[model samples]
Target: MTYLRGLARSAQLLGLAVLVFCAFLVTVLMLAAGGMVFGLLWVRPLTAYCRALFGRWLGRDLSVSYRPEPGPPQPDEEGFYRHDSQLYHGPRFPAYFQRVQWAADDPATHRDMAWQLWFPLVVLLVVPIGLPVAPLAVRAVAAWSAWMWRPRPGAKERRRRTDAVLLAWAQCAALLLSAAVQVALLAVTLACFLLGFGLGIVFLIPTGITHYRWLANLRRQVSGWGGGERIERPYQPMVRPQLRGDGLYRVRNSLYKTETWADFNARWVWVWHDPATWRDLLWLGADPFVTGVLAGVPVVAAVYGAFGLVLPWIWTQAFGADWDTWYGAVAGNRLAGLVAGVLLVAVGFWLPPKVLPPVSRWSALLLRPTAKEQLRRRVERLTQTRADAVDAQAAEVRRIERDLHDGAQARLISVGLTLGAIERLMDTDPEAARRLVAQARETSQTALSELRDLVRGILPPVLSERGLPDAVRALALDTSAEVTVHGRLAGRLAAPVESAAYFAVSELLANAVRHGGAEHVTVDIRHRDALLRITVTDDGEGGADPSRGTGLRGIERRLGTFDGTLALHSPAGGPTVATLELPCALSSPKTSTS
Candidate 1:
């Protein structure tokens, strides 16, 4: 079933990839040739935009697998919000309609899509743009689709409805007269430019600078409250309360709550509207066209020419060297050259025509600060999700502990008392006594298993019995990866610290085998001074965020509780290396057979 499901998923991805390729082709034809209908604009490859907006919703579901709870996320305090001039937080949209609010209701940061902002300017500057209405109509469709007819209400549905009506009127008027607005703005910029750089500076510099200053002030106002401080008067529980006014936290509290975001956005959006400060996303598609040709033309040339030749093989390898002797000699020389040449041709020659331009365009579209800010916000969401998951795990540990004491441990105590009573009666009644002894034996066995499992849950005794070295050796033997243990332990560590370090390495190795698909794993334990370090390196798929799974995160929490540390460095392609360090008392400076 897993194999069949895998094949099906692969086919689905392949189908989507083909569709995306076709859409890009369609986008090219419609934009270049004035032939396609306006509704066809969804073919412009809107994946990136859609991905950002929906990533959090997807991530929220994703977190549950990492022990995520169906509850609140963290940073649930004031500093996370925005503050006003007087440090009051702006109003925040409620959770249910947050995405909708972001789209239609976020007064501070909604800029129409880039092409929507650009084509009118193009029509004004040049007349050659065919089907100018295509771009405008596309924007109208997108805007409508985003907020139209959806069952849910946004943060402020009434405001959005009014705004939509107003925008509809503005858009129609703008469509009729955008050429005029473009020309007017051009005239103003030119009139200013006709004067010295001073006129341009006067028009542009302050526009961006003022907004930057205001945002800086807002960030400072909110963050300053993070340090614990109070207004002078202190309070006792049932007595008078403490009151000191730093004004920072009071403002942060207001911002962290409902009011903070509205105030912050009011300032932040001012930065976007600042003519000098605002990023012109129209540049996203534009600069790529120019720079892409400059960069891509050369690559195109290489793909066709020297890059082809450098693979160091010829025609037979391209076709193949016959099935049995695929690696056999060609022209009395090994076909390594021929095989490499074919791969280069496939990667370079066939792929570039399809790959380069859109990648450039997508990259260009993502160049602005707001896009970056959105990505930053996405990461923050995932991080907070992880934090909430960790909290849940901590709660689960407590529950498990309570369960053992109330259930298994209580049962064991009763069995022990009953066994004692049975022994007292054993001599009086022989057959009944035999049955009681058998019952006691079974209960004892069960009690022993329960105790062992509980202790394993707490800390595996392998950690102390053989220290880090033997514990890791045992873990390596347990995994499918070609795991090798190297180096020596200086000696014993603080028992708790040793246990935490050993478990951390054990979990990391387990992750490498179970999830990483690692074929080669190296575990190196070294002690220097009072620090005991274990490094687990694997040749596998890299991107294992410690916050993404319970294995890594559980290790992290355990280490934290033990005054130990864990770190990972994994990049794409392969090769993940995780390092753990714990302070321990060494029996000697160093010891090794080597």
Candidate 2:
């Protein structure tokens, strides 16, 4: 069974390699035809799919998110707008050229291209090496297991028996099961190849895909048994049937816009070099062949022994004819021959169960992350988080500058003009001068109010005075929607984290009222361990996209500073939920006043 399982896994891996190779060829052809710019329309989606596939293979999520470009800036409180004139109104360039330029400029696109170039090398290295190495490795593991479980000279009888039974059952079960699966896969693959030209293509795609999926599942199962952590891929995008075009249109779209071809190219060039792929290749070569040989040899011997020995003796005795006896008179007994056949069949079934565990263990070794790889991944994550923090802080500073310039500064300038007019009028007309003095006083008061508002916008006084819960409560009260707050958070968070959280919540609520057309909203905040979780849910016409809106992107950037994450779930035609998670420890509780 272990041998069979190994063979099945190998077939799946080989199939994947072929698919990737085909994709690479298509991508190259497209690129040569100058479709690289429009190719990105397909490339981005293709990259996402590859990330998902990698996650499945590795048994973990490998999601990488890209921020959408910011849109034109909107007016501030003082009715003045800021714009990047060059970005929006640069010298005339072709639309296709612009798109191509954008794709070339994107780091994600570059990474994908690099992966495409890297995939072939992995396939060339892993396939040939894995085929021979896998079977030997499985055999070595079986040998090691037997040696390890061998009874010691001073071992108790019961202890020896227990160890023997455990070793026997695990090995046998794994082998039998894996072998059965491999034989089935072999049969299916043959059928697909034979019928592929006619009815085969239709069945081949689905069957081929399912075969690999099961192989991946087995890998995950064995890894878990060996104490390896499982990683899940994030949800891949789903096509809505209702939104789909007609058949003709769909085909045209596939040719013109769908990333299917580009996906093929990316997948071909990037899928083979990973640990999961190597392990899968190992399973393909070892499991099926070992199980077949071990189990097949005995079954063949049983049938031949019965015919050559027992059958001749039986015929000679029954017909009263002289015949040479191969196995003495016992070979003439029909009942004995039947009994031997049954025993041989039973042995065939028994062999696999005894051999499977060791092979599975061999595969498991490949699935586990090496200590070096784990450290490398950790360093990469930390580096990215630090960069995001710096960028977010810079953006915040720019925002503060904009607010002060547009709101408080503009109001102060108006007050200064009014005061100057009053100075010119004071001696010429006493009554008019008195009126001017009162108007100037009013103007100065308005300027002071604007400054206060600007300062409050920067950091609300309520937040400093009472902390997050009270500050959020004030925010809810200020909104038009019927907002409900659920869950309790005690004590104070670090000032920057708290501020980011508060504003993130504020932005969601504002979006709910203004863009979402929501009537009711719910804010749930809870602290668990060293992290704070905030969820804002609203009954609104959903379709909230960060790419289309600067507000959500701003919130994401702000939260990124604290190693935080934001997930938006807003499908069309209904409710939206924005979840925020931040890693931080709370400070001592603010003193409560009655």
Candidate 3:
């Protein structure tokens, strides 16, 4: 019985080996012919077959470790699917290419390919030893397959190290390229200045100064990529020429008939007078020399060390060639030259990650915006926010007026007409008059109820009476979901701040129940560091997009009046959290809670 089982297992192994060999040949041919997508089609079934053979014959489990397939492409607002920056009319091509890239990039795919090539050889070498050694050979083949195909431990760490080495070399290359661009731009700057000031050809001055700004901006952007603080642009805002009542466009004190020369003069003066213009010129002249040294050391060391020293040492010792280089000979000693070469190569690899961050910091000293520019930007922001607030207020007033004219006011007028009718009918028909009075009373009550609802919509009664903390608690009670409120405020907030916060919370709670299908929710309100913070969390189907919903945008506009912000984190599956923050001082130090 034992011999029969061994013979059966040996036959199975022999068949599998032949099948894998044919598959390997086909895969290689398809790959060589530039049909990689078709080639990868062979790897999946081949891996599955190997895994099944190991499990069934040897009773050892082999797991398939291929990465999950990419999901279907999602379309944008215009109903077009986007891959990278290009928009596709349909999802078919994008999805296919995405899968191709996914498979090609997967480490398991490569491992499986390697196994297909090796497994056939293993079977040929070990299976020819006859039936006595058949079971042993099967076990050996299974072990080899398991070792090659299983997920490698510490793979992620290895990948990270590989990435760091690549990034360091890339940064070295980028720095050298930037240095070359700086040298070219600096020459253009001197020529422009010479032409503008020396020969009175002033148009070239602004042209050159404005054009080279792109390079300065690129350096500023590159600083942040090296894991350093971001540098902000320091130039003043450009103001266009405005036509005066006299039908002339004024740039400064000078006025012109047509807008063309006025616009040109305005732009020229704008670029020439700004302090950042000079600072940019100064940075352009200095960056190549200062940052150039930091970037050059690693590259020069790596190139020189590899070709100049290491290869020369190899030539002298291994090939019996003369060592005649000026730098790598190391006093006519080959071993010393080899040691020096290895150390220099190590230095080249180690220096980029260490020095790139400091290079960014040094660039920031000249590239960051100055104090005057900062103040100017702040004023511009405030002016814009104020305008947004005024527009929001006007819209709110119009909404209230429209609601009153349509709802409560119309109901009250009908009630008054019914009362007059009842008075005229009192003597003629007592039963009809009594019915009219009853109808008038019911209509009046309905009108009053509508008035209360309208007021509540503007400002909830609970909010004005008890402040933000208690008001939020009342809100949670009215909601359909099970809601729990945590934390308390030390005192009442300013009226405008409290009102803005109350409505913002109301909007989030309504959205959670209506759209999210949430079963439970939590509201946490606290005052810390002179800021009123409220967080509303719900466990539901999230995927709340502010751009798609008007409720979230209205909440944003309302909060913007008080300089408050709403931050939402709602992923696809469940659990959405909305945080509202408003800066205000607490007044009357009495604890408020529900």
Candidate 4:
């Protein structure tokens, strides 16, 4: 079976080589029929189509390829047909489509405008290509040509472009060298064909393969190292099948399995397998592509050739002869190589992607996720808050009960006892009974004051009657901190939100008065774009750490329950500002019963 399989593969590859030769003839006939420019015009679209098709193939979600033909029963494999959350949970094709549409490199919009683009290419194709230096076309010409030298953001893409040019030059150079050898063989006898054939097989084939592998390896070296990734071997002889226990049930797998199809066809082929000669023939079909780009592409090639090639030659001729004798130039040759190497390195590396790393790092420095993620992680924060509110109400109820039982009830009992005693004395002293009633009235007044204080602690009366601004003003008036309620907060918030806001403000005012030791302070509230922002700033000896006490901690807890945040910016010697940001989603409930 192994012998038959290897034979079959060899036959397939040889047949593929013959097919490529035939295809090259067909491509030549097609180009001749259409004329070179017309044929050339199609290459960009074909290249773009190939790129997009391969990109889509690559960008497909990674699929697991299960093994053992019909497959083995394993615990992990049992879940293969089961839904993976990453594949199943989120939105479907439309979501990915929307993401791809919003992607920086998506082709959807370009597809919509395709009609507008190809018409110009079609018009240019109908005529002999021109490289006229018209002033109007100068910017377009410069931009398009300069694109080749521009740094692609991904190092892989940059290497692809460079290697493509190198591969073409290598192939063309190989063909010329091989053809020269063939010509030399022709000068000899027909018997030399057999000898020449042997030489080509022994020498040219291996050397061509080595040239191919070197170009392939060079791309991997630069791209992998530059991108800071693990580099795989660019090419290797296929490893034999691994033997299982008892040297039976041999299993063979490709060293690097393709995670996506595009890698298999393009990136994969480069990294592992060498493609057949059909790919080379198809590449030959692209000569019109090269010729057209050279012709219609202005003095782009000329500019690259002149400054990139000719000007350097001219400079060498001009400057290299500074010394009369060649021996005298040898002493300063190190300086010359140093200058040349510096220029070469600059030319090699300086471009757009290299220019942008500083900006990327700067943006990364300014924004951080630690605090925001900390808030997001509190799971049952809302439940804890509502429980606290209930506890506060319960404590208020107990205080009210104690005040009534001790003060009012006791005063009534005393009044009864005194009145009874006075009734006995009523015949003798009616004024004594009146004095007992007056004592009960005084106790009643005290009880009322205590009840009022308890009720206010549960929910302040000022919040229910006057809205946030007025309630805040009342706190400010009572505060020892010379407080200024600065900005106008015109709109009414939902009552619960307003109540939360009111209490937060009230607590701050009380703290400022008692502890902050400030001469002046400012409170400002504003409603903008469905967010209510309240800022309280104080001019104090201000090293106010919010985490030190429950005053700010409780305030933070309240804000977190509502998916809001409080930030404190207080420095040691002066002003302290506390800013609160919250969503204005408060729909008022009839919460007065509690």
Off by over 4 Å in 3: 1-176, 219-232, 239-249, 255-261, 289-364, 415-449, 461-493, 501-560, 563-594
Give the C-alpha miss distance for residue 241 in model 2, angstroms. Answer: 40
Q: lDDT per prediction? A: 0.51, 0.63, 0.84, 0.49
Q: What is the lDDT of residue 591 in candidate 4?
A: 35
Poorest 10 consecutive residues by lDDT, candidate 2: 233-242
lDDT of 1 by residue, 1-594 (tens): 244443443343334445545555665566467433321335323444433322332332111011121232223266443222223233342222233323334221122233333423433332223224433333333333334212345569978765654443333232224223333444444444455255544444323334233322222232212131212111111211222354332221233233354444434444434332333323322433543443344354445343344333444457653332233333445455455545544443343334433433433332323544556545664676567557856886997789788767876887888788787887898788778778878887887788787777676677656776887788788788888999986566666566667767777877887888899999898988778788899998988897777788777776665456678899886689898877667764244121
Cα lDDT of model 2 by residue, 1-594, tens digit? 365555554454456556656666677788889888665456556556655654554455556545365343445566454343323232233344555666677666665665555544554555456665654433333333223223334458768766765554454445446667766775665576467656746435334323554654665555333233443321122222122453221321343234554444333223333444444445555656764555445444444555655565567668977655344244666556545645654554444444444444554454445556566665766787788778776876898788878876776787788678878887887788788778778877877887788788889999888878778999999999999998777777888888999999999999999999999999999998999999999999999999998999888877876778898999997699999999998766744321
Query: What is residue 7's positional error in candidate 1, in angstroms?
Result: 76
Best by lDDT: 3
Candidate 4 achieves a global lDDT of: 0.49
Backbone steric clashes in candidate 2, count: 31
Better of 3 and 4 by lDDT: 3
Q: Tens digit of lDDT per residue, candidate 3, span 342-409?
A: 98888888888887887898888888888888788768767776888899889889998988899888
RMSD of each: 30.8, 31.8, 17.0, 31.5
| Model 1 lowest lDDT segment of ten | 231-240
**Where is model 1 more than 4 Å wrong at Cα?**
1-400, 406-408, 420-429, 460-462, 477-482, 491-497, 513-520, 527-533, 537-548, 558-594
